[model samples]
Target: MPRTESPRRGRRPGDSGTREAILDAARARFSTAGFRDATVRAIAGDAGVDPALVMHYFGSKQALFVAAMEFPLDPAEVVPRLVAPGVDGLGERLVRFLLGVIDELGDANPMLALVRSAVGHPEAARMMREFLGEAILDRVASAIDTDRPRLRADLCASQIVGILVARQILELPELAAADRETLIGVYGRTIQGYLTGPLESS
Candidate 1:
């Protein structure tokens, strides 16, 4: 008999496993190339799929990121409460809420991993920035009364991102070993100052 390839031997050239394959390829490409450098066509080529398929599934790079890094709480739902009307203790509330979110996930949380990825991967970083801006900061800015609330929200994010990176990602003992209440107390004050305090004149 003539040599013949098996039916499933080579994924049929144009396979429907394209989405999963694209993601796998994307994960690798994004990790190695970073976000800005990783193109959709490149990812699709790696997965042996058509570029159109990649666009069809992911819609856009931003949407693909949101899907890849879906967090537990919707910022839409959480920020309103955090930035509620007449909220005087914004710092404490933010600290409590953020730490509580981390603690609630125990060991299964994806944040640490995502942070690690973002640290080493530029594509992941872009994805994270988009999610943070659209999901968390924008909502908080809308809910608060602070002058330049968007800037304030960015400041708040800087504090939390630093904490998460140091404690969770780098595992710095000084920060990671601190008790929850102590950490919350300190972080709360910082967040409160950012939220309601005077902004330095630039």
Candidate 2:
């Protein structure tokens, strides 16, 4: 017969390193093995704790994921800033914002963490969609003056997101090698067209 140990036998709640250890283990496991494969048992084993303790601290895998991937930026603020009066020079502004987001957020871009998890989990992708729709698209659409601002906002978002994914995340060669100024120069005009272009016929 297999030996059965008490569920609460491992690390206790007040242990100083328990939280950090679990987070570290989660990041490594989720990054390498993905969310589904990176089970509580595996993370607990990696952190040298009991699986029940992982549940005790984080409740569920979804809750643990949210806790692990929290970000600094408030999307409500960011959307307004992105469309401020002087932001006509959107390419430069976008490049600056993207670089600044990386700098300001440092190791805490929940968007990036969401992307990583989405590579392995559908729920993470859904969360990202919800965030973009509420925090980004809805605000930007309300702020713009055009009749179909929502469509324009969506297109602009898709283009910039695609660029970021290709350049930063996937490391596309030309984009990855280009200087910030060059990238802004190339993509800024394109963004402007999307923002205030002639309305499309139905």
The runs of at least 3 residues in candidate 2 whose Cα sits more than 4 Å from the true structure, single-residue gaps closed, are 1-68, 103-108, 199-202
How would you encode candidate 2's per-residue C-alpha lDDT over 15-79 as one tens digit per residue?
A: 88788788877767765665555688888888878888889988876456555555455555566
TM-score for every candidate vs. truth? 0.65, 0.59
Measured over all alpha carbons after superposition, the RMSD of each candidate to the real structure, in angstroms, is 5.6, 7.4
Candidate 1 Cα deviation (angstroms), residue 42: 16
The TM-score leader among the candidates is 1
Task: State the displacement of the C-alpha of residue 74, model 2, in Å, after optimal TM-score superposition.
Answer: 1.5
lDDT of 1 at 28: 76
The Cα local distance difference test for each model comes to 0.74, 0.68
> What tens digits encode model 1's per-residue C-alpha lDDT throughout 58-139?
7876455445454565555677777775448878988998899898886677777777777786777875676677767887
Position 19, candidate 1: lDDT:
61
